[model samples]
Target chain A: METNNRINVERVEHKTSEKMKKTNFILTAILLICLPFLLVKNPVWAQKKESSLQLSFLKKADQSKNILLTVKARNEAGKFAPAPNASLSIFIKSNEEWLLIKTLISDLGGKASMKLADDLPMDNEKYFSIMAKIENDSRYEDAEEELRVKESRLTLLLDPTDTNRILTATVTQTGNDGEPMPVQEAEVKFYVERLFGKMPVGEEFVVATDAAGKATYALPKNIPSSDTLGNLTIVAVIENNETFGTVESNASAKWGVPLQWEKDPFPRALWEPRAPPAMILFFAIVFGGIWLTYFFVIFQLIKVHSETKIK
Target chain B: MKTTKTITPLIACSLLLFAFVHQTDVWKAPESAKAKKNPVAITEASMAIGAKLYVKECLSCHGKKGRGDGPKASDIEKPVTDLSIAKTQAQTDGELFWKISEGRKPMPANKKIFSEEQLWQLVNYIRSFDKTIVKSK
Candidate 1:
């Protein structure tokens, strides 16, 4: 009975070893079949993502000043990081279409600046449309941005003979067809041009344009001019707007009613130093007295030394 | 009968060759545009106005001589056509007017910006760039 039990156990062990070998071979074959797929890379889905671009005015650019366009780029991680060595194309929208004017490359900080040419006819339009674009980047898709340039021309008219010296201004906006159209409801501010910029003319500085795109302001009697001849340069300004940035025009007028205070060269108060004659007299007297005392002291010392030596 | 068969095949082959040799331009204007005639009269004044407009609007992409060698030509994906070339000059004024109004990609539509008279004037201006033809005339 013991010999019969030993033979049965040997048979069971042989069957178990064969089953283990078969399982190992099957797993090895499956791994070999899937190995190529595991090693091969999938298409770069990250590169297909859309790139983002932002445009801003670099400095205090205005209608009178040349425009400085600044462009910034964003990375794949949604971070506003510098896109160094990237090219950005700048375009200006004319009457017909957008014309590519210049191309700029970003610096280490991913900041690119493009200064518009000074001679651009900015007075022709109330708002200029500028576009910046980055095309066919390997890592990022195409990106572009359009920004509105606030610019316009203001025409100032002065009526001097009227009982109420009214300064009238007409605000005009240029259409895409290069035609000037009246801009209604635009706030036009009148200023008297001075050596250091401009001074407001009257209490009602800001007035909105009427239906005919005209704004009027009553000029005060005592506005000062640059010269004695009552010649004044009055500027009509449409201040900065979100759409139409800024526009200004100037007109010369003989309406400057010079103040009596401006005409007088001498100051009325002691603090006001208009080459003070009283101060000059006082200084001369004080200086002369001190010098005379010094001279007297020197003469006495010299006489005392001479007499002592003789003795 | 043999000669007739030979001539037929030769004629058919010749026709095929002719068709291949004289392929039409890739861009085709609408039937209405193709049939229409230019309304604006071509004069020195109109050409002068068109010249100014072209310089301001088209000089960057289309060169001063209409040679498609403007500064921005290479940056654009599509090859800019040389307006001075005979192939471009062969197109009717109406066709050119239609294309300018309804622009393709990369080129903005100019219908809003230019009036019908202005577009017609542009056609005259572009034709003025064909000095060879102008001299011949």
Candidate 2:
């Protein structure tokens, strides 16, 4: 009876060991299958932590001085992620040229602030563009904005009666509702195409418009003449207290008297004589010398022939 | 007689040269008279329309205040634009109108969505940033 009991106990122990082995194998297989998925998902997790960067500008209350540029950066999770080593650049246009005013790094709060020079002369009469840049990993991404400087409205009139006539130009600024806005001082620039060995010249006239928002300027003496004369373009520019206080307006009219094909008489002399006084004197001297020499020679010949006949 | 022959030819050559130079100085019209017309004005009504449109389309990239920090700006590889600079305010109405109509790369043209008048209104709203016109009060 004791020998039978020992054999039975051994068989039960063997069955238990086999079940433990099978359980271990299944767990190992499941881990192998899911390993790649977790590894692949790692980058997506990192992306969520690395994607927050923002930039903005702060306008001063008075709006008279330099403007403050605020650049904010955060992680993909929208948390403030300070990029202490990150580089920042700010550019501005001054005197018709683009100038890099400052470069720095963001602070601990993931923010960078810069002050742009307000005294910089901005010609609002023309179009202006600005750009800022920051490094993102291995690449550089930049933000850019192009704008037209605001200037007052400018009106130019061309006289249709006379070719040599001068048309007056008037400039003023209007409010948001088209009402006359008060402008301390504004510049009205006059320009025309260059023709007949003349380049289009620009003249700047600075004047404060009256309560009526009107400032008048006399046109330059030599206006460009074109065969297809239409409205001559005039530009008015004003840079006020605001960083973006640049505005411009244009007005044109028919230039010179319209010429009829039949009645349009071409000038008898297209070009004014450019001969120097010295050149005229030189020609007169040469011709007079030749005439005197011929007369003298003829007189001598006649005298000699008459003397020979008398002899 | 010999002097007359030389002087006459010299005078004729000079006259020819003068005539040629004078003719070259005459003004001629350009081949085509296609001049770019003035851009439309930006009005307050257009700004109202642009503001509504901004919420619908641009608010995703450009924030509620036209700042480049919109919700989607963070995900894109490119940095968003900042619209509050003096340099930006310095731009002409025409230039701003052109850019909005024919957007720059990365920023698709809004022309497909907005009419020309709406675009002009947007420009006007942008110009409202001028301190003299857009007071905080």
Candidate 3:
């Protein structure tokens, strides 16, 4: 009876071992099948959760100065770090579409800077939308941030329709995108360039832009003309404006009262020729004296010849 | 052989997907725009007036024959749509008017420059490009 019990127990243990081996084999097979999915990163999943890029803007001191921007990158672990050597591009929104302005590379600290060209448009109000973007980065998804800048522009027009010689100076305010925007209550000073320097014109040296972004000054007809063609160099200046820095527009017009030659106050006596009696008399006396000396010498010769001939 | 079988179907599917994606990118007017009827009647006199206005305004960009080959057409970043094409003619007159009144980038909005009646007339003039459509009208 003891031998029979031992055999049964060994058989039961062998069956149990076989069952355990089968279970281990199934688990290993399942793990092997799913290893690639678990270990290898899926691009679709990576795209769903893109990397975050943070951007900040530093306002420029003047509209003519460069605008400063800073960029920082965040890792998948949500840690902020400088994105070194990343490519960045700047763009401005024009008619709802972003127009590329410039491209730059980030430094080791993930900082990038750029400025609008001096000739490009900028406005005082956030009338312009500026965008900064990071491009072609695999480790981090592409990112962009938008900022508003204050850029101002001024344009001057001389009304050609005014027949009354009314020196009408019109000032039009424009934004960075070259859109005419009304600038109410901003003082605009009009000046005419002279041989020496700019001379302020109009009874009111300062005028204000109306609701239509237009400021009209009855350019006093008395402003002296600068050229022979009756052309005047008119300058519309807006200095120390809170919105727009020193903005000025120079325009030429056939307006302004000409510098009348008759009214010229400078003394031209030395250079200008005039038939003055005193000068004419001096010239006549000098010539008369020379002629008189020549005639007397000729008369003496003639008398000596006559005497010699008579001897 | 197995890899070839898999890659062939994959490439075909990718091409089909690409074509489908780009097909939807073409700008299309909303159903609301399609439903709105033209208020102006198509008439020869109106076309004459619109033709004059087109020469003054759109001729620089849309060309004399409405072929999108005007002098300034190349200066714009976006390609000017050929008004003589069937695709342009397929749009309703109201949709054309709306597009002109509320222009997109590289195109100036003419809402202030042209009146509502004038915009409708321009729609008629653009439609006159299709002789069949003109004959039917």
Which model scores highest in TM-score? 1
Model 2 misplaced stretches (Cα beyond 4 Å)? A1-16, A48-87, A92-103, A108-110, A117-129, A137-311, B1-48, B52-137
How would you encode candidate 1's per-residue C-alpha lDDT over A84-167 as one tens digit per residue? Answer: 666778888878488898888767755676666645534354456778888766555577777776545577877767768888
Q: For each candidate, what is the lDDT?
A: 0.73, 0.54, 0.69
Q: lDDT value for candidate 2?
A: 0.54
Candidate 2 lDDT over A1-94, as tens digits, reads 8999999998899889988889988998899987887788544445422323444343232333232233444454442224554566656667
DockQ of each: 0.01, 0.02, 0.01
Which residue pairs in candidate 1 have backbone atoms (N, alpha carbon, C) closer than 3 angstroms, thus clashing?
A: A150-A245
What is the clash count for each candidate, in the order shown? 1, 19, 7
True interface contacts retained by model 3: 0.00
> Candidate 3: misplaced stretches above 4 Å?
A1-163, A166-311, B1-6, B43-45, B52-57, B101-115, B131-137
Query: Pairs clashing in candidate 3?
Result: A121-A176, A122-A151, A122-A152, A122-A176, A123-A150, A123-A151, A124-A151
Native contact fraction per model:
0.00, 0.00, 0.00
Descending-TM-score candidate ranking:
1, 2, 3
Native-referenced TM-scores of chain A, all candidate models: 0.51, 0.34, 0.38
Worst 10 residues of 2 chain A by lDDT: A59-68
